[model samples]
Target: MKFSVFTASTPEWSPEQAVAELAAQGWDGIEWRVVDQPASPDGRPGFWAGNLATVPLTGLEEEVPRLRALTEAAGLDVSGVGGYAPCKQHDDVERLLAATRALGASQVRIVVPALGHVAWGGRLPTGGDYPELFAQARDDFRWVADRAAEHGVKALVELHHTTLTSSASAAMRLLDGLDPEHVGVIHDLGNLQVEGFEDHLAAFQLLGPYLAHVHVKNGAWFRDEVQGDDPLATVGWHHEWTPVNQGMHSVVEYLRTLKGHGYDGWVTLEDFSTELPLAERTAFNLAYMRRAWEEAQ
Candidate 1:
């Protein structure tokens, strides 16, 4: 149960700068984003999306070693690779695997893309074309798991918004279809807040065994009757993205649950708050996480 910070939180800083900041904050490791997007590349568009079509595959082999050295010099381990794999194309899985290998990552985070008009934070759209969409994703994940094993990496599907596994029950169904040895789950507590804290815990209990990775964050929930909106949409959560101890989430309970389940993987902190300065927010979160780890022990 080591502490790591997802570099996405400091998108404005260069990887070298981000590592130095983390070292100052006493973080043990880093989870680097390896998606094939210019926004995440070495230069330009530091915190915003860049033209994805212009992304090049050349020089990746050379860049990886340099980045690895940079991280190691800062006394940080490359925990995992955060990636995206669209189910529409099988080749995307292969590309993700190659990137993971280059980055020397042991785990790869994948998202099941959203398709069609679906209610915000509601269950995946079903019926008609949905069956085909789900079938494709099922097979796509299976193929990804097999490919990931070949590269000595595990594929952990994120419990992301608007995906087939957006909820605990849905994620359980998806996990049941895949082999846990190759395919596992990354539980994002903030994403589950749409359903409420109790529901989030229930989902975690259900998916406990398959949990391979964890994202630490928090959110508040409410309902808006005027728009006849789903309860998930009325969430007025704001500072829910603050440091571990500052937010409403119970880090002590979360750590207890993880230990009870024998989960010894990286508990990476991902703060998506735009209000505070990035480095300050990350430093605060890192300090809070250390406190939580000490309390847990």
Candidate 2:
């Protein structure tokens, strides 16, 4: 078993500093977030202060190797590579597959769209043809899996809200006939904490064979009172990421559940909140997880 932090949590750090600090904080690996823009620009190290501007999808050929060396030198492993690219986008998926090899990462994460989830961007299905969307997504991801096989890296479909993979079973169906050797899934419970909660045990059991890694994060939803009166209000969800253990879900129990299920894979941290100071949050999350994992053992 191992622990890793998404570099999206350390945007302000130079690549060297990001790896150094994470290693020092006792993390075992890096889950690199490849993005087109900084989610937060005025970043003091926080979740929004993502480690962006590192590699343009067009330029991963050389940058990935250089970044890999920097991470390994700091005593870290490349747990996985994550990006916002859609599976239908062949070019983006190809660069990520190459980058996964260059960084020595065993897996790459692709966020499959969830229906009715606005945060997943335009690829989301708010309302329209249902079966058509599922069919399209399945075909596109199958192609992605086939392409990733050429590079010897597994492409994971992240369980996210507002996408075809809003639940584990739904995700399984999408990847039903594909080779698990090239494609898999991520149990991102945090994303589900909002509008897509799935039964943990059932989800894990079904996806266990194809599970590449599990994402650990926390979030909760609140009502938009301004829409109307308390009882009659149009309740729009106000979801936000929070530090582990303090959110809606019992994260400690979640970790214990994964351990109990015989999953000895990667436990990736993604505290997507930008509230606490960098070291404090990083240190706290690391310490919290260590304790939970120890207790789980």
| Candidate 1: segments with Cα more than 4 A from true spot | 36-62, 118-129, 195-205, 222-243
As for candidate 1, its clashing pairs are: none
lDDT of 2 by residue, 101-191 (tens): 8789989987565564254453334564558778888889888988889999899988877677777888899998888999999888798
Q: Candidates' lDDT values, in order?
A: 0.68, 0.78
Please identify model 2 stretches exceeding 4 Å from their true place.
38-54, 114-119, 122-128, 223-237
Top lDDT model: 2
Root-mean-square deviation per candidate: 5.5, 2.8
Indicate the worst ten consecutive residues by lDDT in candidate 1.
47-56
lDDT of 1 by residue, 181-288 (tens): 777888887766643133545666787667778888765443323456566554443324544564566777777766766678888887776666777788777777
Candidate 1 RMSD computed on C-alpha atoms after optimal superposition onto the true structure: 5.5
Q: How do the predictions measure up, each by TM-score?
A: 0.79, 0.89
